[model samples]
Target chain A: MSSTTQIPFVDYLILDDPPYLQAQECKSCGARYFDRRNACANCFANNFQPVAVQSEGVVTSFSIIQMGPNPYVSAIVDCGGTNVKCTIMKVEPTPDHVTLGMRVKLMTYSMGEDNEGTEAVAFGFEPI
Target chain B: MGTDAIWIIGSNMTKFGKHPDKDVVDLAAEASRDALQDADISLSEVGVLGVGNLMNASAGIGQQLQKQIGQTGIPVFNVSNACATGATALRVAIMAVKAGETDVGMAVGVEKLAGAGLLGQRGPKPEAETWQPNGRFGALSSTEGRIGTSIMPGVFAQVGMEYGHKYGGASFELFAKISEKNHAHSTLNPLAAYQKRFTLEEIMNDVMIAYPNTRPMCSGNCDGAAAMIVVSDEKMKSMPSEVQSRAVKVSASVLTSDPYEDGCQILPDVNTLTKNAASQAYEQAGVGPEDLDLVELHDCFATAELVHYDNLMLCEEGGAVDFFQSGAPWRDGTKPVNVSGGLQSKGHPIAATGIANIHEIVMHLRGEAGDRQIEGARVGLAHVIGLGSACGIHILEKVA
Candidate 1:
């Protein structure tokens, strides 16, 4: 395993001065995605350009999953460009606590540490 | 879609739910055997066998299941499209018969959803990834995937919430009502997993799974198998009068994939896919939703059933609540959605679900739905959705 203490969980995630998410934009259309696609879902474009997306967005939808490997607040956050599925880091998974149309920003933190103490980091959005 | 007569001569299904005594192969072979028996045909008569399955953790299931019934070297094709696997398999069978590729074909679907085994595994090797959000869709190395712990339930609960957000007066109560009705509908289905009814209060009070979704509101993870025998119309003419009178026509079988676009939305996401498939199916059948007498839709969640009400054109936009309250989706309701208790009550065995939906409709088309039977039901539609994703819509009409 790499000994990097600050590792972005997914390849598209870039840990910069102020962390942000990167997505692939279809050359044929303005549509963007978190990962590389062989072909665009829109216009069937094969060429794409990587662009930085502001983690800041509004919650379009949310669901509190109670039965799973972990019980958490799952939200579909629309960042003006695309929708991302992730958990709300700082909120409970309840309708009363998490409201629709709430503003949120992308946040990243160490998820867990390995035996070597190297931390595995993850990204999520939190209510602004 | 062809002039050639294709009819559903046989249908068979195992009582859905957790089956401790049955393995995946056992379930497949048993259902296939019963289907062949029901059709009054020998295994040698079936030229091709199409199998639908989701997880292949227990690899080579098609061949493995064939071994249980003594494989005769007839080719077995396996199609996996998450939950739509079964429907896709049946579609392939229908297409083959329509093309005269085979006079008789067998379509079978089987799955072991929960228990000591993982979703697809037949052993006790705790494959915890099955319980993870997005299954294989989520990138484990991605920070986005790690934070998204909510999978299907959370995704659908958002659908319910979004429907309420868009159309006032829709909430958990409406979702629970759908669940309550399906559970009640299951009470009349002998093959339904949960053949019992729950009140709205009881449904709402059930264990909270996703915020708006409870255990009862969501489909149960269980093991089961279902099968259908699709025969060419030419072959149909040779069958006995009794069998000929019970034939059901396959008017349309349409399937589609997700059309991803900018501004990705959730509750609205499925509606787009469903609408496309439903329209294509209606066109292929040369009929509109207005002609549909009963529907066996993918009720993977309560919201799906509710949202699909509008998507399939069963009701006007934001008209689900009023349409539902008017008894449109009840057992005796004009629409009669999920007369087999739907996946919410029948237990979703992934691949088996589509075939199960087909079995339910065939029963209704043949006037054999018994207690849940709709008088003079003629046209019916069966639907299934898989998350990678694929949507399948098939229209079945009774033919004498």
Candidate 2:
């Protein structure tokens, strides 16, 4: 044991910005899709372009989870360009107020600071 | 869909729940022997073996079970699909028999929950990242981390809440009613883990596990096994004509997975897979959902059972609450659901659930379901949902 105290640190760097969720736009059908695939699901088109979407969308459906190990606000977001299912974050009031079809914006923040004081960020949506 | 090819001649299940005295091998042997006896067939006649299991991958489960039963040289395979493992194994066995790969095949789903003392008690411990709670924002650190805290109760809780929100009812009340119904039915099932009936008052007042869900409303972890024998028509013909006549035909078997699309709530999420699979099963059986006299759904939670009522097309979306409130899913209801007590009361020995569901449906169709038996039952359906929102649905028809 040494007299000098050594601080522990996270081994790897984690991102603090909202990582972009990747999707595809079919060249033939102009249909946008999440969950990456080589061929387009809508028209079976092989030609596609990768698109990065912002976390702005409306809640299509949501559930107020009361049970389980880890309970959170679960919802499905119908982003105008593509629909994405995700969890909402940092709501001050009751989960019931998070209505279906409510407009929301994405938030990016450091989840926690590393041993080196580096921040690890993640993406979540909040009511606008 | 091969006609006059394959049939499920025999099925059986061991009692489910904690059994420290018995291990996986014991459970499997008991179920296997019961199934063989039910079919009146010898172990030597089985040309293929399939085992369904999860969380216990300590080597070859199929081989271990085969050795326990004193049978060897037959091809053995293991299958895992979360909660649908049993159904998946049965499908493989049925397909093999239909394809003429084997004359007689057996599917066994055995698990020892006692060995899995806690969620992560058995096998290699999952990385710490996988243990993170949902809503923990950041770059997921491990493969398990991506899965989040999507356990059975949590997943079904969302469904219960969704039903409450959409139907303008109290989620707790609906949950209590569903629990009461299942408990009442379980009283008639001697093999059920929870045979005592729970009043709505008791269910409502129980300790809360998740919002709107209580201890009585959720399924308990249990240990046991179930087995079924599938034989070709030619093989069945060699047996007595009376035995062949009593055999149930495999009308349809279908499986589907989640699309994981946006605007898809985890709860009440339209499993396009379940819908498509149900459609295919219905088409193969040459019948529709309306023709079914009874159904066995994956009711790991009361909420799950309610959502399945809608998902399986027993009723329209958001109509399950009303159906439950009206006692329409009870034993005497128009479409009796979970007459076998369901996972909530019957016990969810994960690997055993699928085959156990089939066991109960077969009993109902054969007019042997004792006190919970439905009268004039001609058609029955069983649906099971697994991890990643995967689903498997099978439709069984009684032979005229």
Candidate 3:
């Protein structure tokens, strides 16, 4: 195995083996958020707990973005009752391929490496 | 019959488009001077001033304007509330007049955004290749570019798509057709940034900034300013008969923000706040949707126009598609909307939009809007919603 150490691009993304995402669940309202929150956006409760998010999800909404340097699919995936915004990967960015109700699973890919060979990994959802 | 009622005696707006030679203050002073002229009053007689600007909110634009338009040493309020800045400024003047603090007040909104392209990514700038830790979001970048998009066009596009997904009837073609209507309406607006008409095919075939929103469908960012002069009912009766006859009554002025709800927090909830504001405005005005003769809403995007049709209660719930298909929003239709070609073609100069909308309505109420005038328009509504989640609604009525 290569000696490059992997770093998750975001705090909520776990870079361990069989990597998955985590959410901050509000104890009062059960509202889940990817980033750390001081208060629940729904209930305004300060209490929270970290919970593992389901790896698999279904696409609820998507848009084939053509404005950027390259065309890509930007989507909202419903993963085990939690809505997660993500980019769909490992598939063509077209209406026929990436569509609503499509099933997808969490995956990580390297964004780039720093001077000391620390790889910054970003997360996306791919067709399961 | 209420003596506390506020009236708008004069309103004016500069032609919305590029003004390379003039700065923000220059544009603001011109609008302010013209509004005072329309009111047949002098700046020396103005009691208070409220200036709205988003791009340069901190520069004391109100004071700068006073320097050019004869400083009255009145209480100057520099206001900023995103796209609703103009209306907020107008509200300031109205409140002052109603509170008896000032018999006459003026509000001005100005912006210089010509040639400023697509809403760029906001927040920490990512390096050319490698990722770096940033403020607030930490190592995570702004959610704008990554997951879906936070850009105005992209967010509004997704909002429209989600609406379509929930309710049938919204199609790519339907959205394009909505754009065609606005572009066609622009042809009659001499001061609109772009007064060109486009066919549905041309709009759909043009470059797509975001799905369902083409270049022609999105609001053009440009330079412009709008100003208004307000006075109390007591003050209005003292004015000349011609000025009193031309004045428009402020039926309602309401502003609202998003209420907490269960949904994707990433996408903005443009519906609830708008509905709340509209409900409160109608109640205050003692008028319902059918009573309005014309409306100038924030059509920042064509998709936005469709959704706002429902938000503003211009149609039955889940009936925007039917309303559009009925050809009711046309200039000649029952409920004429965006008669100034809307933001889609009239141009959206952020701060100027709110008062600019009010200007359109006031002009129609006074029977001064040439060419695109809504016949015998007695009551009109001007609505604008900003994404920091503020929605402002104003109802105006012509004096019979």
Candidate with top lDDT is: 3
lDDT, model 3, position B93 = 88
Selected candidate, larger DockQ, 1 vs 3? 3
Candidate 2 CAPRI assessment class: incorrect
Minimal lDDT window, size 10, model 3 chain A: A1-10
Q: Could you give candidate 3's per-residue lDDT for residues A1-128 as a string of tens digits?
A: 35367777778788878898888888998888776577887888899998898989887666667786887777778788887878888888765686567899999887777766678788899998
Q: Please, what's the RMSD in Å of model 1?
A: 4.3
Best of the two (2, 3) by DockQ: 3
Model 3 DockQ vs. reference? 0.50
Compare the candidates by DockQ and give the number of the best one: 3
Question: Would you list the rank order by DockQ, best first?
Answer: 3, 1, 2
lDDT of 2 by residue, B11-93 (tens): 99988877888888889899999999998898898888888888575567888888878666988889888788888888878
User: iRMS of every model, one decimal?
Assistant: 5.0, 7.5, 2.3
Indicate the residue-level lDDT of B156 in model 3: 82
Each model's lDDT: 0.80, 0.72, 0.86
Q: TM-scores of the models, in the given order? A: 0.89, 0.83, 0.94
Please compute the TM-score of chain B alone for each predicted structure, in the order given. Answer: 0.90, 0.90, 0.96
Q: Which ten contiguous residues of candidate 3 chain B have the minimum total lDDT? A: B128-137
Give fnat, all candidates: 0.54, 0.16, 0.38
